[model samples]
Target: MDNINVSDPPARITTITSKKLSAKRAQTRIQAFLDDFENRNSTLKGGDKTVTVQLQKLNQALLDESQKRRKSAGEGR
Candidate 1:
């Protein structure tokens, strides 16, 4: 049997402190929220029309915000 010698130092840990969300990250979060809402209401046959409407509105707002960000980025470029 052969003994292997392994003595390697651990890699340094870098901590990132920031309060900014990228467009892609925001979009992903919005999509996840929408998906969660849909999944929760999937089993419910046909009740709570108001809640459904509100969800749709929120989804639209998310889409609009994302589009505005895209437009602004395009303009900047």
Candidate 2:
């Protein structure tokens, strides 16, 4: 039905806010760029920490967001 979006599989933008949308877009771009850079270089972990730093940053952001959501939920209930 309305929930079934065959065209855009995950329905990622269904309830996205402007700031979150921008963050998601930036994450996607950063991931793609990292993938391309790694593929091109093939030695991503030896002397360059670009990919590692990017991954750490993304992980930190996700962790922080999760913590914020959990704290808000606890406060509400």
> Which numbered prediction scores highest in TM-score against the true structure?
1
lDDT of each: 0.72, 0.67
Clashing pairs in 1: none
Relative to the true structure, candidate 1 reaches a TM of 0.47
Question: In candidate 1, where is summed lDDT lowest over 10 consecutive residues?
Answer: 1-10
Estimate, for each residue in 1-77, the C-alpha lDDT of model 2 and write its tens digit. 46666777563556555444544455566667767776776764467777667785895585567678778989998
Assess the local accuracy of residue 67 in candidate 1 as a C-alpha lDDT between 0 and 100: 89
Writing each residue's lDDT as its tens digit, candidate 1 over 39-64 gives 87774675666866676676677678
Question: What TM-score fits each model?
Answer: 0.47, 0.41
Runs with alpha carbons beyond 4 Å of true place in candidate 1 = 1-27, 39-44
